[model samples]
Target chain A: MTIENYVILRNKKLTEKTFELTIDAPELARLSEPGQFCNIKVSGELIPLLRRPFSISQVSGTEVTFMIAVTGTGTGILAKKQTGDELNVLGPLGKGFGIDDTFETAILIAGGIGVAPFPFLINKLKEQGKEIILFNGARNSAELIKLNFENELNSTDDGSAGLKGNVIDLLHANRKLFVNKNVKVFGCGPHPMLKALQDYCSTGNLNCEISVESNMACGFGICQGCPVHSASEDKYYLICKDGPVFNSRDIIL
Target chain B: MSELDFTVKIGNKLTLKNPVMLASGTVGYGNEISEFLDLSEIGAIVTKSISLKPRKGNPPQRVVETTGGMLNAIGLANVGVEKFISEKLPFLEKVNSTLICNIAASSVEEYTECVKILDKYKIIKGFEINVSCPNVKDGGLIFGNNLEAVAGITEKVRVVTEKPVIIKLSPNVSNIAEFAKVAKERGADAVSAINTLVGTAFDIYTRRPKIKNITGGLSGPAIKPVALAKVFEISRNVDIPIIGIGGISKWEDAIEFMIAGASAFQLGTINFVNPKAAKEILEGVKNYCLQNNIKEISGLTGSYEL
Candidate 1:
């Protein structure tokens, strides 16, 4: 968890609110794991105060790319950045996935911007020859933000675009495939979406993992502010510490 | 007592030269404002929460400013407990300030597991159990809302260490006083009030939410009134000491918390907006005592009638 500044190599719009940024912080890129994130320093003004946290969308050779949305001052400033501009980044912080052979079948569920952390996970799992599925949920087909993954896995769109309704609805619509075992479920997104995913996987008895979001001032595990409680099961897990990613059973969701 | 003698104790064992502290999460482990903060000048330093593992937190677009306050979904990102014990604690030890490691847990088990590592330190003066971070599902506000959880976890952690345990309570509740009373009865040494209120902000022009997460916990100068009111309610309900927190930006704000029955104070939200605000407060406390011909600062605590 190194806290340093990275220069923006490029910023391009992928959707109305979504954009992709390439940063020059080699150390952050080098250390980055799929589920981890960087806290972006607010540029040009100090009113925003603390940095914004983002899961590592993708990591390439000398640069790292994050699929970001222009939501507030912190990210709006980040979206507006040009090449050669210095953007402060503190990361690659948090735990990501380990491409274990034990997971024969893996599924990734992402909600809106939550789709950011999975592309790297997919590529990693592909090396192990593990089968993958992606169920993405947005308001509609027009709202679905897609990443150019090298043509792998089953893609489900919640809107009438590619599929219909919610991605979980599509999974339920295709529930017969889950009758088997040895499946690990990975999900990232809004609280309710994660809860829904947790329910579907648990009822289907699929092993599941999820990455949670929290408000953090330090990218390091210093702020107790990003606290999360596991369901009626074990205990608590920090979104910043124990996981941005956790076994679906590890948490209540 | 001289005006300077106004300082009082925060917990049973932790006595402050002044009764004000920078809340965990807001102060960033006392490093951000060491020169400006004079870390030793305040009653104590309540550090941000540390966990058993490292974290990455939320995705991009985690913070947004609301009407009177700001919303943040930063999900406590940290270097984990062992790293903090070695990396950050030593620096805190070097400073004259007594370190109260602020701890957060998602369950009765996680809180104990994380705090158990702290038991190994032997140097931390106290522990602040943060039961109210809005972003995490099991960790923050959930545990805070339940009375059984408030006492159950406090009692579980109480047996582990001899040091005082200060439970930091959440503000986003219909019954904050109920939570405070539970902490006092169960075995908590003191109770701190008003973690950030749950909130959200939007870009009206875009007609979309300002934060990518859609909703966040509100903090900063705007929450002072709500904090003062909560502090007042909980203090009246519980006999144990109350550490008031929320939007404490100035010495006057600190005084308001005291009168509201906070034996001590935590400066939240403002630390980032104004780095030197804590110093401004200490000086102001000194000046106010002198101007009012008040000798002890503790005398200001609960001076407000209603």
Candidate 2:
């Protein structure tokens, strides 16, 4: 992992609150994988002291992008940055998505800002010659982020978008698309949504991997900050070290 | 340019190449941060608190960011002393930096047993007894808050090995100086003042504590002023060498700790934000000494005018 100041190339507002920050970090971009993340120092000041962990949303050539939502002070500082601004980024950290499995079809599921890690995963799956299907969901159309996936399906709770209800409900409604086919599911989003997806995958016996989130200090093993319950052991797996991504069957949620 | 001496003597036996040591719990086993910077360049790296058996640590929501600081209740999560020797030590031995093992246990016997098991490792330069951890329910603050318990743990552990024993004192005590005095009187070579202050944060909407442990030890820039005061109080009242800890983020903070009475300082929370903090702080401190024409960094210790 490398920690260096990368200049911002773009900070485009994707939605009312969501934004995409493109950074000029060739080394990190090259080292990063689909499910990995970068811990960004939002400001030089100590008020928001800890570096905020953001998923490696996308990488193009020498630049790395992070999908951000202004949830608090850290992201609030990130949202205000202009092009050429330098950001201290520590990455590419944690285990990324496993794309080498013997599945012919890759199903991507995203919930609101959980849509962050999918674009990168999509890039990798396409390279591996896997068919792609994406199910994106948000509370409303205003909150939905359209990333122009090949086979994109959008959903909103207000029915103001592609389908009514949540992303899990959308996936359930279209279960026939992958039935009896060699398909693996990839999901990211809030806990309640991920938990529901975990249940849905387990009941359907579908192979799935998920990118989880937590309030972490150091996006490494040292801080022992972000821990997810282990399904196989009686111990806790650190999200920053063991994973920000895990097989659905391997973790408790 | 004249050569400047960056070395410092902690207690009588241990001598570090510099005064900047990575605090325990902040740098686990020296593996993760080793990826960002060379570990050998550091003066010392304290291993996370090792117990007789592996601790699973606290549940989820173990840490939360506070104003200018962060709260952590990791509950002394570690791979135990046996694993430290068998698995962790091999890598640390290769790093070639001064290694000070920090031990935490539920009883005095457990503390000594841990030390006795680890004493045979030639690579370990000293021991930093962590009796001040506020997160654990059993042994942590119980021994730290009690003067006799602190004395007993230090005296017993000191008997098992000739290595330097540095008691990591808690800032939550009524009189931190008294604890330092008792540690010194019981044969502790030095004392690391101000482990961390007991603090907590709440989620108003949920009406619950941010950390699952309800409360955690607070560190970072927020606790620097409090840490300096505790170090000063101990420096004035006690005779033992002081290795100051508790929120030292930069060289200015490290120098301030020395002037206030620290022979050495450890970077805690800053390591999380900047993995190369030790290297940067070391450079800034060296430049500070050269600019001030201070020949020996140790001379700045306890040099406070007031």
Candidate 2 lDDT over B1-306, as tens digits, reads 668999999988999999999999999999888987698989999999999999999998999999999999999989998888889999999978789999999999999999999998899999999999999999999899999999999999989999999999999988999999999889999999788889999999999999999999999999999999999999998888999997888889999999999999999999999989899999999999999999999999999996
TM-score of chain B of each: 0.95, 0.99
Docking class of 1: incorrect
lDDT of 1 by residue, B8-110 (tens): 8765776777886888877767774674567877678887777777655665466655544568876776667888887888888888787889887667888
Scored against the native two-chain complex, candidate 2 gets a DockQ of 0.90
Query: Which runs of model 2 end up more than 4 angstroms from their true locations?
Result: none
CA deviation > 4 Å runs, candidate 1 = A1-253, B1-3, B205-207
At residue B273, what lDDT does model 2 achieve?
Answer: 92
- Per-candidate TM-scores read 0.58, 0.99
What DockQ results do all the predictions give, each relative to the true complex?
0.07, 0.90
